[model samples]
Structure formats: structure tokens, C-alpha cells
Target chain A: MREQFDIPEGVIYLDGNSLGAPPKHVAERVQEVVKHQWGNRLIRSWSEGWWEAPQRIGDRIGRLIGAAPGQVVVGDSTSVNVYKALMGAVKGTERTEIVCDESTFPTDGYIAQSVGELTGLKVRAARPSSLDLTEDTAVVLLNHVDYRTGALHDMKALTEQAHDVGTQVVWDLCHSAGVYPTQLDEIGVDYAVGCTYKFLNGGPGSPAFIYVPKHKQATFENPLSGWNGHRAPFAMEASYEPDPGIARARVGTPDILSMLALDAALDVWDGVDMKAHWARGMTLTSLFRSYIEQMTSLEVITPNTLPRGHQISVRCENPAGVMAELIARGVIGDHRPPDILRFGIAPLYIGEQEVKRAAEILAEIVN
Target chain B: MREQFDIPEGVIYLDGNSLGAPPKHVAERVQEVVKHQWGNRLIRSWSEGWWEAPQRIGDRIGRLIGAAPGQVVVGDSTSVNVYKALMGAVKGTERTEIVCDESTFPTDGYIAQSVGELTGLKVRAARPSSLDLTEDTAVVLLNHVDYRTGALHDMKALTEQAHDVGTQVVWDLCHSAGVYPTQLDEIGVDYAVGCTYKFLNGGPGSPAFIYVPKHKQATFENPLSGWNGHRAPFAMEASYEPDPGIARARVGTPDILSMLALDAALDVWDGVDMKAHWARGMTLTSLFRSYIEQMTSLEVITPNTLPRGHQISVRCENPAGVMAELIARGVIGDHRPPDILRFGIAPLYIGEQEVKRAAEILAEIVN
Candidate 1:
């Protein structure tokens, strides 16, 4: 698995939570797409395979996230998809309020705020546990794992709460998607959006995917109704008629070059067991966290619980400076503002030795 | 310039207006980006160059489109950008109507309808020339070149008319950009959105760009305000405070691989004169249209007058069949509904010989 990635020599990269390391074959796949498909085949390539890539690659992502076929489609940035899910969720309902996790990745909260203004719904921010999921709460946007603290949330429990109050839930899976298995279908979640670049390792800023289950497809009123979502897109009709399936959530032309790269990246998950991989992630994080606690005086912010996410964060003095010093010594991690350092544990390529090496470097920097 | 592209040996691809051919060097550039920048550099790639790519590549695209630096930023799909331009242009106004070109590419009309529904404004579809620009019109969305008919519109006159009514104007340059020069800055165009894949020679479905001029930057209110548009995006602030420049038009993480591919593709424009290239386009279109008329009974729909776009549409019986036969004979052109067969003459890589040869093949297919 380590040989599958092209991690640089002596560079212990712990920033997979920000941007994942690329698979070695992605370079070749991208070249083939650029030269053979796009360059040689040209427009005919769209019909050849490019036209349905959003749904095709989306289903591949669906396999990892516990979604069956025809429920997810990929394109657009996470911010745009967040806007789509929130706006599409509340289209026909009489709900007057949108609740969002106060600690969500800032983009989700920002888009929810804009959707609130557009739909004339009041926006409220609260912790995931304390969300006041009344009948008037149109939707609640939650991050599966906190970006800054790497804190995992109870998706099944919170979703049941929202459903009990007759409200909807939209999950931001940016930090959680490929790290562990999520039962999106079993829970019957209303909408889910996640980035492919993080733990999914789909290169930088690859397009995000949105899940609109089969039951919800018929009435999903996409606000950004581009022609790609139109039933007969090639007919080029003046009026907008959305496709009857999950593709109705699609907006605009699929970013082919980026999308196919993600398709290639998903090949890594074909034979790996997500549950076992998640257990390995726990082992690596526990090893790294225990080393830090014993060797340094930093306060580990990530909770020491049974079901934590793939990363660990610690509060320290002058985190930016400490991160730079660590990076200077070939330990690559990132610092959030104010004073926290985050280290992502990607189980596919990262292992026990790399974790101990990174912890040793961190201990050296602090001492 | 034709040698700079990897056009297949026998295929006379006349669909560059739909999807441009890839440049010869884009394959190598994309490989380097995917392998070295993303694979080895990891998260450090953002600060190295990815953080500013939207604006950096935007300036390069600006040179070809007659926009000065700092007025253009690139990301997202053209449909998404159209929504942004329309919504951002209509904010802080008392006008109650948005007039869109009646025959726009369907996505533009669809997005305008969605924006109309969201903003509580009346969306009226009218021809570019016959638009009744009244004081109540907030903005008029016009296509610089008609996608189906290849008829070019008067940007200067229509923009003046809209200004006369104290209304803003948003231009969809999907068909016109990179084929000719658009005086967006000189015309004081309010806002513009255009795709990069066509004549700009970005890869298929590369991210589109939006131009918000310096004067309008302060008041531009982006409806899909995401964290990327935040004043301090890295600060991870909860509130959305738009960057006080063209970047306010950006949403979400920059699609790095696709955008950098576009950046590499723009290198083809380095030594080319856009005005001279547009003249050559007129020449090629004229030759193709004349040859078709001389040898076949096809009724050409593109005007025979000056200032036409790069495409020439002809009405033929069984257009789908005719286009298929033409493609089978190595002459690649596309067809629209009922009877329109569209041939796009890209001046950058296409020339007199390919146009004449394509016309000869078309004559054989029809006769």
C-alpha cells in the first residue's frame, strides 16, 4: 500500500486530512485521459464514456460510503453541492428555519447562511447534540467529523432525532468519507455531500459528490438547475426539465480531467476492507496520541473515545511556528489558527513507524 | 499552431466550438502537476502555487479576452458562474425584471429562471436585438454569439441600451470568447461568464471563469457566497466576508488539476493575435459555407455578413443521419434538432485546407 503512493523520501506527511497523497497510477491515468481520450478522441469521447462519468464515478464512491447504485452523482465543488443539497431539501416544504452545526467546515455554514437568506428561512447555529430539531427546522447541516478538532459525530443518532422532529439532515463528509464506513442508506439520510480529495485521495480540489436517494429524486428541486440535469440534455430545449434520477442534482458540465482522476483514485478502495482500515486508523492515531501525551506537554484536543475520526489535533503555543519547524524536519502537518496542530492518519499508506517518527519529531520540536 | 495540437490524423474535427482539441503539451503539464506537485508536495502545493491559481490563470485568460488584470477569476462551471453573475449583478437594485436572450444555450435560460425564482424578479426571455430594456429591468443576460445559429450579437449597443435604462448587463461568452476579442472593459460590461474548453483550448469541461470589473467589485453581492470568497479564507472564519475584488466571484476550493490544465492550455495564446485569428476564422467559415452551398442543396443559416462567429450552421434533411455519415467519413461536425448541422471553425488550429476537405466530404454525404 505504501508503494502505491508517491510520498516523497523522508517526508512524513500527516496532512491527508487537508489534501491526500496521490496514488502513483493517477499520473498515468490522467495522461491517458488527456492524450488518448481528450486529445485523440475529442468530442466523440463524451459519448464514449465522459458523458456519464459523474454518475459512474459517483457510484464507485457510493460503494465506500454505504450507498447503493443511482443515489449519488459527482460534479461541482463542495460549496456548490452544499448549496444544492440545502436548497433542494427545502424547496416544497413549509419549514421556516435551517439549523447548522456551529463547528462545521466554514463553507457549509456559509452556504447555509446564503440559502437561509435566499429562501427567507432563519438560520441558527448550534452544536450537533444541542440542535433544536423542531418541526420548523427545515434541515440540519452537520459535519461527520469536525475539521479543526477531528471530533466524530453520531450520524445515526442525530439523523433519527431530525427525523423524529420531521426535519431533514445534510451531512458534510469532507473529513470522514473514506476513513470509515457510513451507513447513509440504512439511516435513510436526506442528503450528503463530501469531497473526494481528502481521505479519498482524489488529488487536489477534485469535484465533490452529492447523494439524493432514489425516493427523494423525484421531488429534489435543484436550485442551480443547469442543462446537465435536464432530461434530454442534447435536445437543447428552452425549458428546464430535470432528469428523474439522481442526476437531477447535477449542475453544469462535468469537469472531465479532474473527474476521471477521481475515478482512477477510487481504484484503491476496490479490494480494501473499510472496517479493517478504520480499525488500523484507530491503532495509528492511538499510538501517535499516546506518544505525544507521554513525551510532550501539549493538550490533545481530539477526544479519546471509541469512534474518533482519522486525525488527531493538539493545542500548543505558537502552532504556526511549531508546524513550520516540524515541516523543516520533514514532518508535514498543518496548524489551525489560534493554537492547534492537526495530523491526519490515512490507513492505506501510513503505518505505525511513520506515526512514531512523526511523534518523535513533534516531541523534539516542543522540547 | 495546428502542429501544436494532437488532432487525429484523418479526423477533420469541426466541433471545436463544442469542445476544443487538447494542446500537445497539456498532457505533459498535467502529468507533472499530478505527479510532482500533488503527489510529492502534498498539502504544501497550496501555498506554492495552487492557492492563487484562479487569479493567476485568470490574468492569462484576461489578456486574450480584453480584460485587464484583477477583473477576472476562474473556477466552477459556466452554468454556476452564470448564476453568480446574474445574482451578483441584481443585488442592491430595485429593478424587478431579468431579461435573458430567448435562444440562449438552455443552461443559461434555466439558471436565469432559477435566479428569477430565487430573487423574486420576473424573468423575461427576449431576442438580443428586440429586448425592451425598461427602467424596471435589473439585468439583461445576453449571449455574445448565438450557440445554435452562430449569429453574433452587438455587445456595445446592447450594453449601452441597458445602461440607458439604468440596468446592468451580463454576457455569456461561451461561444464567442477566444474566437474573437471582446471589449468587456472598454464596453464597461457589468459582469461576464464564459467557459474555457472551447476556443480557449482548455481540456473538456475545464472550470469556467467570471469577470467582475474593479468598479463593481465593492458592491458585487454573490448569492452563493462560500468560504473561498471570504476575506481571509485561511483564517477559517465562520462569517462570510467576501474578498474585495474579482475573487469574490469565486466559490469553494479551486479545482487544481483542471485549472492548472487550463493554465497550461492558455500558453497556446501567447504569440497569437486575436484580431488576426478572428479574421482567419471568418475566412475559414466563409470557405466552408461557400463550398457547401456550391456543391450541396443545404440552406446555410449563419449570416453571410461580416462579424459572424466561428461556427456556420446549415439546415439539412435528416441532420442526425447526415452528421453521422459525415463523421463516419472523417468529417466531424455536430447537429442540433430538426435540421441544423453545425460546423465550428476554430482559427487557432484549423485552416483553409481542412475546411475545403470537410466541405467536399459533406457534399458526398448529402448528394
Candidate 2:
């Protein structure tokens, strides 16, 4: 159905993992918000709809991610949301260890280090293979999928292990949100944060979302409580009394222009089946792996038989150069440091032929 | 002249202090970015223009605030920046006190409480008359201008006293930046945070500015250390090493759309002297004060002295009702609790005629 949408010609977009390509209707949405809501409605839009974008959109994202209504609020960058989630997760807990993987994204590690350094708590972030879950762990912070390696974490098992030790777990869902199925509610994860750009296709710099399970929503303390999160924002209270809903996580007035893009972008996901999305991912990734392995002496860092997210990572001896070559050949993907080339498969706007051709292009380039 | 710029008509645009009216050029700027920088350039925009917005516009804002060029960086909302500044201020210090005012905006107090409740530090906040500026204080956060009452703090004395006690001072410039003149450098204030939407007239949710003086630049730590803050954001370093200058304060890629509005809005300030801005503020506040005093038995909450910020606050019997009435009558301002009406005066755009007519409208309704 998204064939009706327009993506630029000759551009093979694989960098959705970094910043999603613009949604079809984002331009119209931006124009409307700038001309009407801001130009005409002015400040009254706060009362009209300007104020509730965070909660309204949060609930919409919650529907996709297995969260109930009123348990997710969108605002800030994903990293900031990570900071707030970790800070709130650690609050009032006697546990001293904030467990995470050392291979985590720098922001997550930085957040863990920041929380630990400022709070004097110990952040014991080891490789998952070497991790020891203990009662002293306050929380576990992990990406649902590794950004560079594209390795998936078993949410249910890790969450259960953390919970069995009386430790809370906060999940970063940046790469897993739209292309894969998640059982956040079923897994009983404590908190989650993610950006919309990767798979959700919220355009660049779109606001990020935070999920606090209904059980944790009422108790979460958003460390960055700007006036927007006030119980009665217009009441102008001096003390911070959070709104009882997921809206409590909002830190400031959202960028409505960027925000409306997310809403418009989500419209594309209305009828698509997610399994079909994952199948497309696996098919493309498998083609990519098999083709590159046969065509050239390339090392695929993405695991062969492990559960994976919607991306493939291969190690070329000159990944950056090969990536530039791939881009020149009209196949767009990104290269991480140390010879890792990453490609994300998103089916909403991606077609099977594109994947086949992309693999063929990789094969030719490698040869 | 700013008068050449057109604001939409017939709306008594009072909430410039909440979310500033858009600069006339912002729509076109947004159009340019949406169609060109993003739709066309796509990811290349990051390496070209998008990545530099945080420090680039920060320096623009620093020019207005009398900060040196390398001392300010823009990113995060005021609250997140508050957490970063406050957290960074207290690390490795012997001081145990984090001082604030109870009447400070919840974001300010909330962050101080966060530092204490998250970290093991002790927090000391005071009401107006009882605040303690003591030796044990690691940092003192005071609103340069009170959000509710339009009250101003004595930056020189406070910063000097804090320095005398080996403590740092963090100024929340939300109510002060682009309103009138305040010599933060002249006052030796160690660090400051200010939003863009208020008097600076960036659009809603503009990235806030953080000022770390040139002297303190070497020791500053960005507690919110996302990839953007790393010394080589593109290098993708394994360990975090912050950029040497104000770039150390950047945490995330800024919203370029919002950053552009602030960039253009600073044009509203060029060549217009701040001395004239301050003098006009006094005149406007005095006129509005006289008008409010002439008719109503309402109390004036803003201090009537040389040191206060440029806004005027008049107490009403029922603030919400009065604010509604004022809005209906087209006199734009904000109402704070129990019963306080506050108006911010930006002399570059607001003049004696606007203030006098605004007072007459208030007098006609309140009487």
C-alpha cells in the first residue's frame, strides 16, 4: 500500500537505523502545524492540542510496543529519556549495582556511568556472557538489539533474571520498535526508552518515547520535570507534583513540527503485519550474508543462528571504503568503526526487489 | 528594524514568555530545511550543517548574554541541562550543600532534589527571605528572573559570595535571557542555563543554552554525555573523551528547525543596544505598575527596585479568571498561583506605547 508513497529515485536507504527517511505526509503535516497551530492558534494551542502531543503520541506508540494507554509519554532525545529512566529506576532502591552490557551504546554506558558517578552507585556493566545477576543490582539497562553487532537480547529471560534478583530492568528499544514484535508487557520489563526515527520512520530529530508499565507509571519520578509535566500545568505549582499518568515523563514543550511527523509516519503501519516485516528482514539479511560470503572473503559479524533484530552487520576489511563504494553504487548503508557495515531492512517502504538488487550489487562490488 | 518583521495580527500575543511568537522568516526556513537539507541532502546534512547547530547557535546566544564565544553550547531542554549542569558541578567536591530556593521553578528544585536524592549530596533550599549562601554549598541555582513573580536575583553578590565559599553558582536564565541586560561574566556566575522561546523568540521547545565560563571550561563535565559530546563524535571512540571547548556541553544533535528560528531571532537583537533594552524595561514596568496600582487592591509581587528583571507581576483575587479576562481583552501575559499576573517586556520589540495601552486594557477590565 505504501507504493503510493514517494521515496527519492536512485536512493537505496539503509541508514534508517540512524535517521529514518521522511514520511510521505511529513511535509504537509509540518506546513499545517507551522501555518495553523502556531501561526493562528498561537499559545492557545497549548489548551487546544499543543500540550498533549507527548501523552497522545506516547499512547499511540504504546499500542505498538505492548504498553497500555497512559503508560508512555514521548519527549526529549532517546539519550535524555535513558537518563530519566535510569535515574527513576534507581530511585529509592537499596540495590547498589546498575547492571548493563559494556558493549552497549555509548549513551547507555554514559548514562549508567553518570548515574553511578553522581549517585555513588556502582555500575557493573560486564559482557553478557560474564554477567552475574545479584540482589544488589538496582537495575539492568540493555539495548533490545545491539546497534553495531545487531545481536538481539532475550528480553523475557533477562527481565526474569533481573526480577528474580529484585532488580528492575530498563530496555532501550531504538532498533527494535517497528520492524519486530515486542512483548514488553508479557516480559514484565520495568521501563523502556526509544526514538521513533529508526523503524517507526519518525523523521529526523523526532521526539523520543518512554514507557513505564502501568504498575510503575504512577511511581516514576521524571528527574527532568519541566513545567509541562505539572499535575495541572496551568495551575503553576511551585513544587513538582507529577501528572498521575505517563505524561509525567515530559520534560518540556515538544517540537510539534517534528512530533506531527511521527503521527503522520505511524499512519503507514496501520495495516502491515509485523511478522511479514521480520520475514523480509531475515530474507534480505540471509541473501546479503550468503551473497557476500560466496562472492568475497567478507566476515559477517551478525550471528548466523542466533535470534536477531532487523539488521545485518558484516565485517569488510575496508568497511568504510566499501560502504562508500556501496553508496556510490546506489546501495546506502552505514559503517561502524573497525570494519563493520550495517544495513537495516524495513519493509513498509522497502521492496523485495530492492533487497535482491542490493545483494547483487554487493556481490558485484565484492567480486 | 524588528518592526519590519510581521507578526500575525489581532492576537494579543502575551505568551512570548511561555513560547515566543515565531519569527516571520521561520516558516520559510522550515520549508527550506524540510525540502532541501533533509528531503534532498538526507544524511549528508548531519556532516554538513546539522551537527554544528548546538555549538554554533550557542555562540550566537552567548553573544547576547555577554558570555565568551567558547563558553556556551546549546542542547537539551532547560530541565535536562539543569540536571547536567548541577550534576557536573558537584562531582569530586568536598562540599555537601546544593542550595536553591523553594520558590524556584520545580525544574530547578527538582534537579537539586535529584542531585541529593539520586546522589548522596544534601540539598538546601530557601524561601526568599531565608536562603542560605554558605561554605558547604557546592552549587547555588537561582532563577535570574522568577518565573512567577518577575523577581530578580542579585547575581553579583550571590556569585561573589558563592565563590568566596568555594561553591559554584548555576543560574537559570529562563526568565532573563533576551529580556534585558545582565552581565553574567561581570558577575562571575560560574554557569547558567536559558531557554530560547521566551524573549529570544525561538519557536516552542527550542534547545536551551548552557554557559560555562571560560575559566571553568577545562574542568566541565557534561553529565548527559551522548555521542555528540565526545571529543570525536565521528570517530566513534570506545571511551568517552569530551570535546575541549563548549562542545563538551553538547549531548545530542539539536533540532535544526528550532535552531534556525533562534538563529534568525537573534537578528531581532542585532545593533539594538541592551542599555536601551534595560531602560525601556524600567519605564514599561513602572507604567504597568502604576496602572495596576491605580485601580485594583491587588498586591504587586515583583520587587520594585533597581535589581529586578524586566517583567511586572500584579496579584489578583483569582488569577485564572483574571488571566482569562485579560486574554479575552487581548492583553497577553501569564497567571501564577494564589493570584499573580506576570508580563515580560522585551524592549527591542515592545515600546512605551504598547505597555501604556496594555495597562489601560488591564485597568478597564480589572476596575
Top of the candidates by lDDT: 1
Model 1 alpha-carbon drift over 4 Å, by segment: none
| lDDT (C-alpha, whole model) for all candidates | 0.92, 0.77
Model 2 chain B, poorest ten-residue lDDT window? B1-10
lDDT of 1 at A165: 92
Best by DockQ: 1
In order of appearance, the predictions have TM-scores of 0.99, 0.93
lDDT by residue (A252-350, candidate 2, tens digit) is 667776777678777877766777767777777777677667766777788876578777788777888888899888888888887788988666666
